[model samples]
Structure formats: C-alpha cells, structure tokens
Target: MKFARSLAIGVVSALALSAPAMAQDDASSSGPTTNWTGPYIGGSLGYTWQPNTDREKNERIGFDTNNDGNFGDTVSTIGGANAFSPGFCRGFAKGGSAADGCRGDRDGKVGWAVHAGYDMQMGSLVVGGVIEGGRSLVSNSVSGFSTTPAAYVMTRKLDWNAAARLRAGFAVPTGTLIYATGGVAYGKFENAFNTTNTFNTFTESNRKEHDWGWVAGGGVEQKVSDNFSIGVLYKYTRFNPNDYRVTAGQGTPPSLTNPFVITPSGSTTFARTNDRFVTQDVRVTASFRF
Candidate 1:
C-alpha cells in the first residue's frame, strides 16, 4: 500500500508540473499576432514625383491680334466659356499656341505629412479611416507675352496637398500587414502676371485657393514594438484643373505716347492650365497606437 501511495503521489506531482509546460508550449506554437486595433497618429517624410501630362494637354491660352482691346473670343477649354482659351491682339484672329507654360521642371519634390486614424481589427483584417495633410513640393508655372499696355510677364504656381482616406489591410500571423488606401484629396494653386506694357507697369497675382480631388495607394507595414509600427507606401494623386485665364482688355491703361500701339491688346488665355496634377509618392511612415 505504501509503495502504491508513493507512486500515485509522484504521478500527480508530475502532471501538475507538466500541465504548465504543456500550456506554455501551446501558446508558443500559436504565437501572438500584431493587434492593429484602436486609434493611431503618425508623421511621415518622403520623396514625391509627379507628371505634367495634364498641363501639356492644353497649352494654348489666347490668340487674338486685333489690338481692339477686346480679349474676348471663342475659347476652347474643359468647362464652359467661363474658362477661356481665348484671343488677344487686334486686326488678327489668332489661333494655335505652344505646348506648355513657363512652368519649369517641377514634377518631383520631397514631401511630409501628419496623419491620424482609427482601425477596426478583425481576425485577419483591419479597416480604418484616416485624415492627413501634407505640403507637396510640386510646383510649376507658365509665362509668356501679356499684350497689356506693353509686353508683360506671366506666372503660375501649384504647391501643397492634403487628404482624408480609408484603409483596409490583411494582417499576417507575423504582425505584418499589406494594405490599400484611397480618398479625396485637396491642394492649393496660385497665378500671377506682371505687365509693364504701358507707361504704368503693374503686376497682378491670384491667391492660392483650395483645389480638391482624389488619391490612392498601398503599402506594407510591420510592427516594430508594442506601441510602434513602420511602413513604406506608394501613393498616386490627381487634381482638378485650376485653369486661370485673364482678359487684359478688361483692365488696360492706354498708352499716352502711342495710341496705335494696341495698348489695350491682350494675349491668349491659358488652356487646361496644367489642370491635371498627378504625383507619385514613396514614403516611410512610423506611427504610435493608442
């Protein structure tokens, strides 16, 4: 009986110790997945490269040579006549123009952003909403002869952008995620001109306004720690046309010295005005989750 009792006690003790060990083994085999739930806010800095296809499409602004001071003519543009690609000059019905504006090589630039989002985590999927704002280092302008009082100089600039996006990702067992995202985007555009055409040389500028559109992209993100993650993403964005056309005849100061100099003549307005702003962004991202 004593021997039997000792054997039973040893078996019971062995089971008690082994129970914990078995539990541990099961946990290790299953492993822990990265939890991508809740809210997060992060900042990212990256290089952005864009194309100027949209600008090249519509280059002709105006072509009227009839110095009658009437810059109005049949305009061809995306929208209605409110957006003009009209005429300038006097005694001449102008047509045809160059391909692009004076805007220089402004397709690529370095950019940075601040973003925050809330994620809904499922077994293997994550869905979230994020709002972000960043300044794009992309800018370009077109300049040519402004038939104002005298030959004038013109300029335009496109800079900065922002977005609100939705994200959906599939999480792997190793705490890494691959996701796609897209949303509405916003930005600012500005235009200006300087005309010393007449005795009174003057400059005109347009304030940058809100230009809204769409953006889409995808990235691979990995969990670096309990509260931090890192990711690399590629995003593409396209903006609406910010076509700006001006009528010099509307506001022209006649030359006191030369009345026949077509002092009131104007140049063709801008075409699509580089309407399409497309950008490719390669970014490195880091975030902290709460």
Candidate 2:
C-alpha cells in the first residue's frame, strides 16, 4: 500500500508540472492570433494625379471679351469674339503659338499622409474610423490668348488636405484585410495669375481659400505581425471650387507720350468655371497597432 501511494503521488506531481508545457505547445500550434481590434497609427507614401479632362475655363474672358461694363455686349477681336480661343495648356505658359498646342498636361506628383484610427473586430468583420492629414504637389493652370498675342495664366495649387473617414473590412483567415473607406474631406488651396500683356494692370482677390468635400477608397492590408501591418490603398478625392478672381485694366506705357495701345481698355473681372478639384491617389502604407 505504501508503494502504491508513492507511485500515485509521483504521477500527480509530474502531470502538474507538464500541464503548463502542454498548454503552451497547443497555443503555438494553433498559429498567431491576428486580432485587429485596437487603435492604430500609420503613414503613407503615394502618387497623386489630377485627371481633369477639360481645360480650365475662364468665365470672365469667355463672356466679357471687350471688358465693357456690360457683359452682354459682344465685341469681336482678331482671335474671335471669345478671348480664350487659343485654348489652355497645362502648367505655366510657354511663349509663342507653337508652344501653346495643349499637348502636355501636368504630371503626377508624390504625396504623403499620416493617420490614426481605432477598430472593433466582430468575428470576421472589422469596422473603424480614422482621421488623416496630408500634403500634395498637384497644380493646374488655364491660359487664354488674346489678339494682342499675349497669354493670361491662372493657376490653382493644392496646399494641404485632411479627412475624417469611416472604414468597414473583412478579415480573411490568412491575416489579410480588405476594406472600403469614405468620409468628409477638407483642403487648402492657393491661386495665382500671370500675364504676358505689357499694357494691362491686374488686381486679384480671394487668392487663398479653405474648401470641403469628400473622399472614398479601398485597400488591402496584411498583418506582418500581431501589432504591425502593411498595405496598398487607392483613393479618389474631390472638393468644391473656391472663388478666385482677377480684374484687369489698361496700364500706361513707360513713355506717357505713347498712347495706350492695348485693346479692351475697360476693366474686366475673370473667374473660373467648372473648377472643382479632384485627385486620385495610390499609396503604400505601414501601420502599428496597440
């Protein structure tokens, strides 16, 4: 009886020590848990492109060619009644008629962004909200050519942008997440004007503005570790046009003896039409979860 009792006690002690080791082995074999529920911070490097098909429209130049006090009066010029018949080229204007063929548009630019968000995982589905801020190097311009053989260039530049977005995703067993996100976006824009006309004086207004719009996109992210992930995303962003205005008037020559030679001597105000700004972005992102 004493021997049997000793053997039973030895077996119980061995099992007690081995229990923890067995549990650990089982956990390791089940694979790493990829719970996406938590807060995360991330950054992205991306290319942004503005794909506007139409050239920038100059409402004032198109409608008020004579620069008269009345917009209804149609005054014909050598370049036709419309002052913008020469059309527009992307970026800044290149002097001469051959260079203004509108052959090239602005190229895509590199952009960067930083974001933070929280996610709640419900089984295979995950939902979250995020806030992000970024900067872009995208710029666009429109040019109008007058009979005086001069170019008037108007430019809009994107300074910075921000967004508040909500996301919904499905988590696959392979530690990959596919998500769609959309939200309200805000942006800052700057406006500028350039003219080759030597006989005109220009005044500008509302050169800078803050505007609001929306953004939508989707992405795929793979968890590299329990607390880290890498992903690729595509987004489309758009904002309402901001008011940028310019008024042009006749300028006196260096020699007051020379009469003001330029046509359309009256003051006229110019504005943009169909000027909503839109951009498409493709980015690679790295994120850390807490």
lDDT of 1 by residue, 22-44 (tens): 44544586532368898999988
Candidate 2: pairs in clash = none
Deviation in Å, model 1, residue 162 alpha carbon = 1.7
Q: Which stretches of candidate 2 lie over 4 Å from their true place?
A: 1-32, 52-87, 96-103, 253-266
Per-model TM-score on C-alpha atoms: 0.65, 0.77
Q: Model 1 Cα RMSD, Å?
A: 16.8
Residue-level error in angstroms, candidate 1, position 67: 14
Give the whole-model CA lDDT for all candidates, comma-separated. 0.58, 0.70
Supply candidate 2's per-residue lDDT for 10: 51
